[model samples]
Structures are given as C-alpha cells and as structure tokens.
Target chain A: MSASSERWPLRKLIFDTLFFAYGVALFADALGAMGVSAFHFTQDDFIQNFSHYATFSLLLTGVMAIVALVANLRGWTTPGDALFASPLRKLELSARPWSRSPWLWQVVIVFTLTIVVSVRVTESSIGDLLDADGLQGAWRLWSGLSQPNFNLLPRALALAAETIFIAFLSTVLAIPAAFFLAFFAAKNLMQGPLALAVYAVLRALLNLSRSIEPLIWALIFTVWVGVGPFAGMLALTVHSIASLIKYYSEIIESVSDGPIDGIRSTGANAIQTVWYAVVPQIVLPYIAMTVYRWDTNVRMATVIGLVGGGGIGTLLIQYQGQALWPEVGCIVLVIAVIVWLMDTASAYVREALK
Target chain B: MSASGSPLLNVRSLGKTYPNGTKALSDVSFSVDAGEFLVVIGLSGSGKTTLLRCLNRLVDPSYGEIDFAGRRIETLQGAEVRSVRQDMAMIFQQFNLVPRLSALTNVLTGQLAHQPTWKSLLGLHSSTEREAALEFLKLVGIADKARVRCDQLSGGQQQRVAIARALYQKPKLLLADEPVASLDPATSHSVMDYLRKANRELGITVICNLHYLSLVREYATRVIALKEGRLVFEGRPEEIDRAWFQRIYGEEARDVGIQ
Candidate 1:
C-alpha cells in the first residue's frame, strides 16, 4: 500500500470521528429513553420511531469505529477491503467491487448510511406515496385536473396576458438601467477614487439584491405598490437589473484591451474611446443577454402573483385553496405555454446573435 | 518642418522606474533634428519601447524634461498633453488598430484629437477628413482595403494600415516602437521602407526601435544603443562595429542577418 493510503488520512479520520459521535449520541438517547437516565436527545417516541436503517447504520458505525481504532493504534490505514478481501473474494472475486477501489467503497457506504439516517430523521417514507387514502385523494385531483373548467378560460387567458406583459414591461425597463450601470460596475472602466467607490457600492448592491429571490421581491413590492401586476413588474425589473448588471459588467470587464489602447493612443477622450472601442464589441453580447433575461423574467412572472402581485399565480393559489383543481389546471396550462414559447424564442434569438 | 537651428525634440535625464521596481529607462538623453531618421537599438527589455512612448507621453517619465517644438511638454497635463501627442503619432509592435473597425475608420481615429467634441463623439468625420484618410490609405498601398475590418487583414496589411493611420496624423515626429518586430523578414523590410519614405518625403522626424541591426543599417541615418536602461552609444548607424556590437549585445552574441 502507498504511504498516503497507509497514513490516517485527515479527511477520513475527521469524517469517522464526526459520524462516530452521532452514533454515540443516538445510543445514549435510546438508552436514556428507556428511563435509565434523566435526559435524552428527544422523547421516547423518537426511540420507537427509529427504523431498521438506523440499527443497520449503528452496526456499520461499530465496525468503522473498531477499524479506525485499530488503524490509529498500529499506524495503518484503509484496513478496509484488504482486511475482509480474502473471505469476500473467495465467494466472488470481481463481484466484491471494493477490490478495485477501497476508498470509493468506503465513501459509498458512508454516504448511503448518512442518507438513510437523514431520511429516517426527517420521517420521509415511501408508505405515504403508496397509502390507500393518499392514492384516493391523488385520483380525485387527477380527475379534476384532466377535466379543466372551460367556463373560466376567458378569465384565465386574460390573466395570462397580464402575466406576459408584466414580464415584458420589466425586462424592457431593466435594459437601459442595467446597460448604463454595467459600465459603472466594470472594474476596468472605473478608475480613480470616486469611480472606484461607485463600482464598490454598485457591486455590493447588485450582489445583495441578486441573492434575494424574485418571489421575495414581489412580496415586498406588493406592500409598496398595492397588490397588482404593476407590483409584479417592479419586482421582476429589480431582479433583472441585479442579474443583468452582473452579466453585463462581466462582459464589459473582459473586453479586448488592444482596441481600447488603439483608440486611447489616438488621443480620443474617455467617452469617445469607450464608444468607438468598447461599445462595438459589446452590442451583440448585450442583445443576446437581454433576450436571455426576458426568457427568465417570463418564467418568474407566472409565479410572483401568489403573494398579491396579480398574475396567473394569484388565480393558481386561489383556486388551489378553494379545491377548484380544474380552474388551477387552466392557469397552469396557460403558464406552461407562455414559458415554453419564451424559452424557444429566446434560444432562437440568442443563437442568431451568436 | 525644420523651422530653425534648434532641434525638433530634445530629452535630458529621462528615466522611468515602474512601481514594481523595474528600471525600464534611466538617464536617457538625446536630441532629434527635424527630418532625421533615428533608430534606437537595444536587446529586448532594454527600454526602447518605453523611451519612444515617453516622447508621446504614452508612458509618463518618472523624471525628465521632454522639449518638443521649442516648448517644454513633460509637465503639460490634460488637453495640452493630448495636443502634444497629436503632433507625435505612434505606431505599435502589435499594430493596435481597432480590429472590428473598418480600415478607414481606424485611420480616421488619428485625427480625433483635433476633431470637435460633438463630432468625434458621434463618430461623424467630415468628407474632407474622410478623403484625407482614404488618401493616406492609398499612400500606404491599402486603399482597396478601406472598408475591410482590420482583424480580417493579413499581418503585413494590418501594419500598413497602422502606418497609414500614423501618416494621416501628419505628425512632426513619428514614433514607431519596433513596428516590424511582429512581422516576417520580407514584411519587415516593407514596413521599414514605409517608415523611411515617411521620413524622407513627409519630412517627419522618425524615432524607431529596431531589433535587427541589418534593418537599422539599411534605414537609419543615426542610431542610439541602450544597455540595462542606460544609453550606452549615440552615433551614426555605421559606427556600430563588431566589437561595439559585442559590448552592446554582450559577448558570445553573434550578429545574424535577417533577409
């Protein structure tokens, strides 16, 4: 074995210790839950609810603990497949896959144990998905969805139009705002203290705003602008500016310097230099990004109405709350068609630009 | 343009030490009479490019005075500095014309410093200026390539466009920073011939950096040598004998002919 594999690897040791601690805690909690101790990790109910996966994980944890202890005491590593290799290989040589890559096998076992333990802790189950009562409820929902209410078609179509317009208006509003702000945000163009200060502040603002989801922006705009498609448009516009500015600024930052030097060497002033050298190289890229942003905005516009920004989502949540599955289906279908069209159109436009 | 007995350009104690402590040029002093073809000979990083750039204020000299047309221009700032650059056109090793712009547009850029603010801002050159730019393109033998983007042109063609752009500026001093360094030997001679033509016909004082001593001998009226950022030799082109070449380029450096 190589020295690296022989030594107690830092990553493996850390992982084993952390997982061993979890096993110890689980055992302590279960022992305490039996009323032999005053405190426990949770209630006695948790002990009862612990699945077979946890018990199996506990046994694997015991095996790992023993192996780690032996390895540390003897200045060895992996002790893994090679230790159990003879017996397992005798049964089936290649079938015992760890014979090829012991570390991969170790990682797979650890990750599997972690996933099973997490699934049990979260109380997630296949049982709910297979239950008679749940299946009946799903059947009812499906039947209603299959038979969409045509009586609400006109209203749903109108709301769909409003959703698309909100996306369109916001994307249009964002273009000039983002285009101008991008120049200021680009580190290359922003020279001197005052310009650099603006660059720093604009970067912070863009980063802060971009991390927040458009849905959250919609919620805020609902309160500020009084629940309507206008609020949704404002929300999308704000988010688009943050996103477009980052993309646009990166594009501006990477522009070829040869042309910039050429223009500047000719004694062109600041604005003329950028106009002649920078802008020509950037126009096609900017147009492509705008199309891409519009496509994203269209997808977001359909969902922003749940909080009060009027659109298809407003109708979706309302109908869902009232158990009007057919009406909800109609709105979802409208959203799907518009989002699909925008996706296709933007892809085509961007490809043409390229 | 030799107006009087005084030299067209004079430098005294010129030096530039970059912020990173690279002493690119130091104590470099020389004078260029109007219409003289002066070539600067140095090994790579001997500060030949830095010296030419300093004359046009492309790279600010850390300390020195640059006297141009009987006026001190080293301390001149802002628009005045640009006016000085307008009279000292530069050609680069990489032929730094905007690759996406038409050859005509690239040539027109040379006149931008003298253009009205609104006119240049809108990229609207007057017909006379456009005609003059085309005339320069014709002069450089690339008139047919006026509408072609510079990036589409061959290496030799691109350098020709660069020379045309500099010629259109009609500068008193033409600064060519190893203008043939990136070109093939055949193209190298062609480019050097253009520089020589500009010197003789236009009466433009030329300060060129050259790598090949062969080209320097053929084209240069006078030559200056720099070693480790200090001027080591200043004389006629023929003065660079074999022993001097060994001293300038270092012993064990054999002179090889290019074309």
Candidate 2:
C-alpha cells in the first residue's frame, strides 16, 4: 500500500498543532508591531488596558480550543465539523460520505482565523462606533428625514428627470458600440490567428475598463468635460460599453450552433448569417440586459453628481454640505421615487421578454 | 452502371484528412445523376456525413477532383463557391431551423441567397416568395403549422418544416445527413416519403445518409455503403444482402431492422 493512503492521524495532529502555534506567533508579532506587548507577561502596563471583556473573551476561546483538541484526539467529531458540513442536506447535515475528508474542518478553522486577523488588522473597536458624538449625529440625521421641503418639489423633479436622461442617453450610446464589440469578442465568431489576437486584446481592454467603478470614470470625465451632465453621460457610456460587451459576448458564445450551421449551409454571407441566425437568438436577451444596464445607470447617475458630474446628486451634495436638511430630504425623496419607478418598469420589461 | 453520357456530379479520388489526424474519407470516387434518390448506408464515423457536407463544400476536401455540370467545382472560390452551395441545399438530422422564428420565416430564410443585400437585411420578402414558401409548407404537410414557432413543433413536424425550407432554395441537389435519425420509425418513413416525393415530383437529386438498412431498402433508388472511410459497396438497394452487410459493417456486426 502507498504511504499516502495510510491512516496517520498522529502525524496529522502534530502538523495541525504546529499550524495553530504559528498562527498565535504571527498574531503576537502583528500586535507587537502595533506597539502592543500582547504576548509579553513581564510588561507591567499591558494588563491595565486589557480590560474585563478581553479577559473573558480569551477565557472563552481557550475553553473552546481545549474542547476541539480533546474531541479530535478521541477520534470524535466536533461541533465545528457539523457547522462546516454540506449545507444542502437537511437531515443528513452532519453525515460525511468520506470520514477522512479534511476540507470541512480546514474551512471552518481558516474562516474563524480570518475574522480574527481582519479585526485585529483594522484596529477597530465597538466603543468608537457607540461614542456619544457619533450617536448624536446619527440621531440628528434621522430626525431631518421627517420633514422635507415640499416647496423645492419642482426643482427636485427637474433634476430627477435630468438624472434619468443622463442614464438613458449613456445607455443608448453604449449599446451599438457594445454590439459590434460583442461579435468580435465572441469566440465562435472570431477565429484564425489574427482574429483570435484581436479577440484577446478586446477582452483584456474591456476587462480593464470594467474593473474600474463608474464613480472613478465619472471623476476622470468631470475633469475633462468640465463638471456637467455631459461628464456623467460620458462616464456611464464608457463603463456600460465595457460591461455590456462581456454580457453580450457571453450570450453570443453560448448560442446554439444549429441555426448558425443552417444559415451557413444556405450559402448566406457572413453578415446574413449573423442577422438571420445570431440576431434572432440574442435580440430578447440583449434588450433585457440593456434595460437592466439602464436601471443600474440611473442609480449611478445620482452618485456621479457628488463628484460634480451634475444631476439631482449635485443638488443633494450642495444642500447636505450646507446642512440644509430640508432641501436634502426633498432631493432624496425625489431620487428614491424616480429610481423605484425605473426599477419597476425595467423589471416588467424583463419579465415580459422571459 | 452503363458508361453513358457525362453524369451531373462526378467525384474522383476524393479524400479528407482532418487536422487532428483522423482520416474521415479516402479515395472515395462516385457519380451522382440528376433526379436520383441515392441513399448512403454506414455506421457512425464512416464518413457519410463528411461526404454529404463535402458535396456542398461545407467541408473542403484536402484533395479531390469534382466536376458538377461540366464545371470544375473543386477549384472554385468566393462567390463561385457560394453560388454552387446555393444550388445545393443541405438538411440536418437535428432539423436545424431557427427555433425562435415562425416556421414560415425559417422557410423564408432559404431565399436569402437569391435576395438583394438590403432586402434580406430588412427581411423583405415579395408576395410571390411568400406564396411559394407557403406552397412548399403545404407540400410538406405542415401548412397549418407554418405560423407556429419551429421549436414548439414535434420532431416529425420540424423535419417537414426543414424540407419546406430546402424547397424554398429551389435547389437542384439536396444533401440530407441523417434527416430522420431523431424521429420514430413511423415518423422516419413520413419524412423520408417527403424526400422521395420531392425527388420524383420536382426532379431534385438527393443524396442522404441513412442508419437503418430497412429505410435504405424502401426509399433508396440507388444505394452506396462505406466502411472505415472507404466505399465498400455500391449498387441497387435490393443487391445488399447479409454477406454484403457483414462485409460493410464488420464481421461481428448484426443487421438490426427498424421495421
């Protein structure tokens, strides 16, 4: 028999212990780097700031660890094993098909360790979030939501319309370019060495552009287009084009080859093949996906305004900056209503297409 | 086989070796006359499909000498090749209709080769073309389902629609690659009957691949058998006997009748 299939629980236990010790040492090193003598028992000042909560947390963790160790040594499973078992099975949640599979325990241990490491690295505390000044400010913000300045309704409505128009115009501008890019990027359509090279280049370019958020694009365009809805439209168009190409190409890629071969065998030209076969299959999905993009762009339009790309968001930022709570409340109400309307409309269109 | 005048299609020393080193067809020479319902019989991977596709230049032959209507079709390029395909309509086992489109529209797409670029793009069909499409649909016995989506139709009905589409091409030669493979025994006869009707009534030459020897016996005016990419037998359908089947299929192969 091979050594790999051998039952060596003792060796595994030793490796697991070594890994646990390494984690503890790493955590201490991090704390020490942050000027906390976390592992030094001789430090006189360390215990003063440790607090009662810290001591209780440490005691609880130590007890849990001991229980896990004892359970593992006795060849019995722990609660951690049950917690990481297949989530799909209701009655057989704790049942393991292969008792020797180590993925469950490894995942549970890694996940818990990640949470602790993240919290320590961020140096965040619950007390700072519950501070009196922060709580008071939050309360004040909530209170302003009760009374909106209805007198600014007309201006708010106009700005809301402008935001929607920005989204619509940008989506329209992006679609045709994305449509052309999709065919070139689709692996089924683009063959040969040169065409494949073009496909790769286009995919890389689209991925790079899409990886940046619309807000970042808006900021860059605001600098170029001089702070207006034009900047917002341009920014949204660029981001929408990159993202829609990916979606459109995926649809094109997965399209059934039956119709394509049917059209091709008819001696239909390349353009005719796409128009007759490819276009029919993709039309409904393209419309539904583009409508979805338009809905997302409506939401993005408001956010872009904070960067001076113009819309209801610009008014929102202005009123909120001056602490004119009533005007800010009015803009927020108008934006919410319009966004809700767009969402409902797009959802209806998508459902109808399906 | 008398040494008569020139045949409509003459193929000599045809061969196809795929890039993956699979020899799909080798030294396959055959002649097809006009208005003949020729059936190709073979097991899977015996180059029947490849031979049919190569007839319309769907799969380019690595080396071949093909003369269609006294023209050296093997050396034709671009528009000339496309024009040759326009005259040779091909149908598939899967009934490759654009599933989303109405059966009538899928049939209308067969006229794409004859239409102008602008008209085809605009999906503009003349009243006469529309009438002709419906007539073909009626001929296939699916005129009532012409307005229905092709995907919603049964396998037999979809194959009829495919036949209707091929009729719209007004092709001189029809190549069918296992057109009834997906249908039941009765439905298979029904679809094959339509092809036989087209060949007899419209004077269209058909070369089709058939899996069932019984179907070949019933429908084929002339029959050819292939084994391991080589043409093993060629004669009238009634000439293929148990010894011939053994030679074509292999020693261990048993003849399975469909009916």
Candidate 3:
C-alpha cells in the first residue's frame, strides 16, 4: 500500500497534469462566471463541466499517483541514473499566481456544504420527533407494558427454553463443521495449487452465506420447513458456520509458526504436526469462539422468531397483533431473562476456562 | 553410532532459490563429522537458517546432493523425508516452545515422531515415555519446573526446556539455529554449555549456527563460515584470526564479543 513517486515519473506527471488542469479549469471557469478580468472562459451551467475531461481524467491519474506513492514508500523506487529525470521541482499550491485562498478553507466549505445537502435530501425534521398524538399513543403502550401478565407466564417460560435450545443446537452443529473447514481455509495450511483452490472456494462459500442476515435465512427456511423453531435453528446454523469459520481460520493463520516449525523439525509429518502442535495452541481459542458464537446465535434466534420462526417472539407478536399488551409484556420479560441468563452463562464459562 | 567414522552428514553443491527468486544459498557444500561440534557463522540473511532447514528437508534444496548419515537427503520425499528428520534434532533461536503448554508437555513433543501417531495426538504417552521425558527435563536442570507453563518460565529456562526437547529426540545430529541468539549474555553461555554437554557427553554431532566468534572459538572443534550464501572458510576455530574474521564477516564488521 506504499510506493515511490520517483519510480514512475510518467505516472506522477499524468497525475500532476490532471490535477493541475482541474484547478486551472475551475479557477478560469469561476473567473468567467463572475465576468472577471482577462479570463475569458464561458459556462452554460455553474457546476456542469466547461472542462469535463479534467474530472474523468482524474480516475486514471489518481490511481497512478497512489501506485507511485505506495512504490516510493515501499522503497521500490531506485535513484534514476538516466536522462529525462527532470520532474516538476516543487508542487506548491500557495505559490500559484491566481490562488485567492488556501485549499484548506475550500475543503472545509465543501465538506460543510455536503453535510447540509445530505440533511436536506434525507428530509429529517426535529420538529416532528415529539408530535402530540404519537406521545399520547406511546403513553398507552408504556402503561400496558408496566402492568403484569401472569396468565401468559407458563407459556412464555416454555418458549424461552425453546429459544435457548435453538441457539444451543445450531451452534453445536456449526462447531465441528467450522472446525474442519477452518483448517482448509487457513492460509498457512493451504499449500499447493489444489489446496489454494479449495481455500478460495471455501472462502467464497463462507462469504456468500455470511453476507445474508439470519432473518433472511430464517424467512427462506420458514418457507421450506413451514413456520417453526426448526427453521430458526437451521438459519442460525448457517450463519454460525460462516462466522465461526472466519473466526477459527483467522486464529489458525495467526498461530505462532515457531511451535509448528519446532514440531515439524521433530520429524512429525503434516498431519501429525498439525495434530500435535496446531491443535494444542488453537484449542483454547476455538472453545472461546464456540461459546461466543452460541451467544450470538441466541441473539439472532430471538429476532428470527419475529418472522414466525418460533420462541417467545412468536407468542409476543401474536398477542401484540390483538393489541394484548399484558400478554406481550409477559413474553418480553421471559426474553429478557433468557438473554441475561445466556450472557451470564457464557461469561462464567469463559472466566472459568481462564 | 557409525563406528566406520565416515562423515555422519555430507553436502555436495547444495543450492536453494526461493519461490520469490531470492537465492538464499548457492553452490554451498559442507560435511559434518561424527562426534564433532561444528559451528556455522555469518551475518543475518547469509543462508544459515536455510541451510539448517534444508538438512531437515523442512525446505528442500533446489539442486545438488545432501548426503546425511550415508542417506541421500536432497532426493528424499514424503515418508522417507519425515523418517530421516527424526535422526536430526533442531533447536531454534526463538526456543520455539509452545508457550501455553507445560514444560513437560513441550519436552514430550520431542518424542512425537518416535511414538505412535495416535498416541502423540492424544498425548497419551506411556509411563516409560513420561519417565524418559522427565529424565530429559532433569538433564536440562528443570525437572522441578516441569509442570509450569513454558510462557511463565524465564527466557533462559524456556531455552533449557527447548534443549531438553531436542535431546529427547535422541537425534544423531543436533542442529542449533543461533540457539542463544535471543538470550542474555550470561544465559547464552548456559544454553551453549548444554549444547556442548550434548556434544561431549551425549556424543551428538552439533552443527550450530552462531553470530559471536567468541562462542564459536570457545565451543567449536571445527568451524565453517558462510558469506553471501557461499562457504568462505572451513577450518579450526583458533585459525580464524582478526584478519580472517574480517574476511569472513566483511571489513566493516567488528566482532561484538559477548563477554
């Protein structure tokens, strides 16, 4: 990500020329727009390009400049002992004869204007945030939430248990799958063309699965499996596999090569070396990640049930649809308890391991 | 032991060109005799590590023959290569002990290749194997500290455990890749003394790569100097005078003797 500008003089020149042309064109256009002095430039629209070529030329020239900068920083550029070494001696913007103000002031104005424009485009209104009627409706919902609903308590407790189980099962299934895939996905483990190919394929598959949210996966699985906790667990499983693979593989890649090499030197073959050296180092971390993923999966499972994928959310949504706030309150309490318990359990397990 | 007394290891025109096109070593050849403490000395990036790696087939030589213990190592592959590696134990500059593991467990790793694959993976060593590993820890004078995690151990203690691990391999040759490079001056000598003990008492051939000429002169029965991937000198340590030292490690280089 670093380069020497000296290495690619031509690229630097191209970048300089484009940037210089843009500044000059803008300056000249501004002068003409103001009907000022001897700068006889004309413009149909204020912002539209009188020199549109300058903007487009920037795309290529900017890339070249970055490449040169990176090369220079990386020490790739050597001292040129040839002809045509003469580049622009100094590139000072303040020294430009036509410059009326510092570039920093212009940049500040541009950024401020961009934020102002964004605010207008988004149509945000602070005045509407605390509207009287909405406040009245919020009071009703708040009053209902405050009241107890012991009638739905038994059902809510069952749903809470089911939700936690869904998370547990999904994470349990994902762990072994992720554990195996991580070895293949790790850069250090993947040697030779075939292994690299497998790595790329596995990485692509993981990325594809991980990109979609568990809610979306739940929706698809709900359609396939027909609206149940089974669909929710399946959705969580897919996401956990991808997430765990990423976590596990990165840890695997970052493991100290010293111990691995030491084991290898002892004449352990590739499998033996990994089994003996790599496993011991990574096992503790892998267990921690498994617990972490299960925690995440539980959070995801709660949301998945909002789409009729089971748990207390399904019961809460059903009651809320009928405007049954007392029943909804019961389900919400159950969910809070479930989450707190999971958080405590995972933390305790992690602390105990250490 | 090779009673015939031919060189335990030999190299003929060993050369290595890495994938990125850096020639780490070129046309370098040397042989290690049985029961001799040989030292390889050079500045960093002078192919010392690469040479040790090649001897164990951790990195294969690009061309030329490596004859080790009468075995043609340069041509070795797969199981053949792995089996041959067991005979040559290597201790590294970093100590390379698995920090999280206990010192005893790290030493047990030295016997990983010698035992059944399933047993090593399960870490289910026999009581006899455990006793032998304990004996190695005792040899390195850290038997009392066997159950302590390697990361908790001092730098010198960790290195002693590393030496114990190497000795546990019961190897024909001990390849020390700047074994004391990471240690303090006092600890460096202590570690070197263990290597000397392994060579003198245990009769293990030691091919140690070192930076300090003082350590080389003190320990080495024979010495080989590598400069820019080529063997520049191969003679007795005392023969390397101030003039010869300049020739081996360029004129600008001064030997920073470690006390």
Best candidate (score: TM-score): 3
Docking class of 3: medium
Candidate 3 lDDT tens digits, A1-354: 123535556644444444444444455444554567455333344246645645655654676456445544563321221122333422333244533433344444445555554454465678666888878888888788778588889898888888889999999999899998899999998988999999999999989999999999999999999999999999999999999999999989989999888988888878778886788789888888789788878778888999978887787788889988777877888888878888888888878776
Winner by TM-score between candidate 3 and candidate 2: 3
For model 3, the chain A TM-score is: 0.72
Ranking 1 against 3 by TM-score, winner: 3
Model-by-model DockQ, in order: 0.45, 0.58, 0.67
| lDDT digits (tens) for residues A217-292 of candidate 2 | 9989988979999999999999999989998999999899999889888878878889999999999999999999
Candidate 3, residues B23-73: lDDT per residue as tens digits? 999998888889999999988999999999999988988998987887788
- Which CAPRI level is candidate 2? medium
What lDDT score goes with residue A188 in model 1?
93
Say which docking band candidate 1 falls in: acceptable
TM-score of each: 0.79, 0.80, 0.81
Per-residue lDDT of A1-354 in model 1, one digit per residue for the tens?
Answer: 345644545555545554555545555545554567643445465477577547756776777677566665664424243343344333553454664755455556556656655665677879998999999999999988888887888998889888888888999999999988999999999988999999999999999999999999998998898998999999999999999999899999989887777677777777778888898889888999988998888778878888778888788889999999988777777788888988999999999998
Taking the true A–B contacts (Cα pairs closer than 8 Å), what share appears in each candidate? 0.49, 0.61, 0.74
Query: Candidate 2 — which residues are off by over 4 angstroms?
Result: A1-112, B1-4, B17-22, B74-76, B246-256
How many angstroms is residue B17 displaced in model 2 relative to the true structure, after the best TM-score fit? Answer: 4.1
Off by over 4 Å in 3: A1-123, A344-354, B1-6
The candidate 3 chain B region of ten consecutive residues with least summed lDDT is B113-122
User: Which of 1 and 3 is ahead in lDDT?
Assistant: 1
